[model samples]
Target chain A: MKKNEVPQDKSNLESVNFKELCYAVDENGEYTTAHSTGWDPKTIALNKAIEEIHERTENAKQRVLNNTTSPIEYYMELHKMDLPILSSYVGFWKWRVKRHFKPKVFNKLPQKTLQKYADVFDISIDKLKNIADGN
Target chain B: MEIKFTHHQSAHCENGVVSNLMKHNGFNISEPMVFGIGSGLLFCYIPFLKVNHAPAITYRSMPGSIFKRFAKRVGIKIKHEKFSNPKDAKVRLDQNLANNNPVGLQVGVYNLEYFPDEYRFHFNAHNLIVYGKENNTYLISDPVMESVTSLSEKQLEKVRFAKGAFAPKGHIYYPTNFPKELNIESAIIKGIKQTCRDMLAPVPIVGVKGIRMVAKLIRKWPKKKGTKVANHYLGQIVRMQEEIGTGGGGFRYIFAAFLQESSKILKNPKLAELSTEMTQIGDLWRDFALDLSRIYKNRSAKEDAYNNVAIQLETIADKEEVFFKALKKAI
Candidate 1:
């Protein structure tokens, strides 16, 4: 029940984290590589939730970037934001995107080290590739 | 394990109105220096059946517990069983040294394959401290025979109880003394400290030049153009606290490991040290997380499991029992 609702379902029940966003958008396990029943549920949910909320979260970011005065306006401009924070208020997605989504700038380093950080934060390798390719 | 110093000062800073109010008083006094140790700790490691009782921290004389008060702070009504204050509540609180109450307790039953007969040993208690005048003293419910010892049998007699079953449970002592376990715990601390240090790294670059370097890549959004910076800052701090909290748990794990290491290790060493640190760090982190979690979790919604500090700590002990069963396999 975020102020700015987006979408909600078992598909989006993951924590609103970077990896969660990437997973939700995953039409299939094309990017997941292999099965991992051994991972912590929170970590797993975070990865999938992030994937689901990716587009809506980005859209919401764009809206907020444009303008934000009232709560309604704030919701309209953002993708996810539970206006009045609630525990059971699960809808559209909890407006926890900003908490998990942040801009990262890494130095030119070996691919292994960079990938480790991504794994720690559960950021998608493909997204890192996109960022690297952009440069 | 090693913990990051972070300026060697953990005293909370209160500015603006809080600072102004302090000026009204004569001498400068620091508020309770709150610290977040870590979560998923094993305060009471029992290998048999146990009970997870919710630890309740209140004014003792006050109605309900801190959980209820926190609910009140957030403007929510919790239908608690209203009870009249106990006449001994004040007397007990006065005699006791700590200002807090039990958060909760845990109960669990374990099946031992070694013992064909499943002897059920249920633990029904919680750790608490009586308030101290200066920094405060720690209150440990039980002292393991083979880990560490802070209080000599003589010192145990000197301690007094104010509110709960601490006196009835027993004195604090360590039963483990193996140097290997201590060294290992210390190494783990070092590892944790290193991880925290690496995480604290500021922006890879600084200054306008660094900004330009970053901008050359991903387009930078104007600061606060879309979101409130305060929220993000708080979130980052929360995560940082979580990382360092491992140190808090490492402190206890070292103790558990020591216990596993030997009966000889626990004899004369200062077990009270471990108990004190665990109680101190546990109280600080558990206290805050309980409040914050309530807001983050239940909110104005239905009550959740272990939502308050007392209940949460109780759950920790229960989880520890889980660890104990799993850890037995290690032995």
Candidate 2:
């Protein structure tokens, strides 16, 4: 936390707007003012968060391809949601959400249910069902 | 219509918004000053109020309260509204922008496009400014961003109505009147005393004592929930400290900086000494975060790691207790 303290180099610090405190001395040397300097450690923390999201998304993606999970599983992971969170978002019971992870049940989900999931994930029903190639 | 507003990035959103809005209206104020005057600093670890499936661990007061308090203390009148209808909300916002009036809004972070992909979360207390609109996009001055940006009306609506946990509910605010001068001296003392009261409040789950409560829980987490669950919970604490709406070190550094500014304004050397003490507390908080990150990086952290983190938390709580008590008596 010095005005010029450098953050330890971390791979995830790329493209981060880490906020930090910076002090500026006045011309009279009577006082120093503190201002935000935007430092590296902030980015490192954010990067760690993003890495967690991507790691979960990747694992969920693998499950979908292996036919062990449904596309809802992939979308949930992609959006960094846990089962309880996704359930709350879609207003579904957690048990039902766990059931929706099965391809058989997920494929039979009502259009309205699909829409709810789509809205929560900020995607369209088609994309939610398809688990978009780009995702 | 365009409002000529200057945006300065700051460590926390609400403080930045207050600072920018005040400056836009001809008042030169810093974020820390706004924060301190508003009595925005507080610590609470509520176990029942879940955010993202973890207990609510907040580093500041609830959203919108700070601005309201700061405005009142400085003798400024402000207008605030929360629309139940998204359509009506958008119309009202557009009307304000068309009048060349800059407005402050609370929106969820998950859908803010300018946010880094990894940083997106369901936090609903993020503050930003909307100064104008062009075509389908609304010009934005999110204090956390390096430069002003724009968001599509569609995108804006989505985030405005973001549903889960601490929903924004289409809240918007703007200053209706401004005072020419402020009682800086009185405000500073009031800020100091209020901060002390909050930190030393008798509530077992809040203030300095709350920090200790969380420390105790941290020590127990591993024993009750196994290592993986405990590590994830610890990571959540670090996230709240370093990443979430909190400024660095859970607002410790920002509050410390506020004290430093208060010292100069009030010409009190004792407050300056206390400011340095607060900075040391911020350092301790940062060290705690570093330790948490190291545990996350190395999943095989032993029981000693959790105990060490708990001890750090206890030490921070103890220091803050003393600091706030002294701050209360100093003013």
Measured against the true two-chain complex, the DockQ scores of the candidates, in the order shown, are 0.01, 0.27
Q: Please give the lDDT score at residue B52 for candidate 2.
A: 49
Scoring only the A-chain of each prediction against the true A-chain gives TM-scores of: 0.22, 0.70
Error of 1 at B141 (Å): 37
What lDDT would each prediction earn against the true structure? 0.24, 0.79
Per residue, candidate 1 scores C-alpha lDDT tens digits across B73-168 of 222233322112333332343333332321111111111111112111121122212222222222222211111112222222222211112212
Off by over 4 Å in 1: A1-56, A60-135, B1-267, B295-331
**Candidate 2 RMSD to the real structure:** 3.3
Give the Cα error of residue B11 in candidate 2, in Å.
1.3
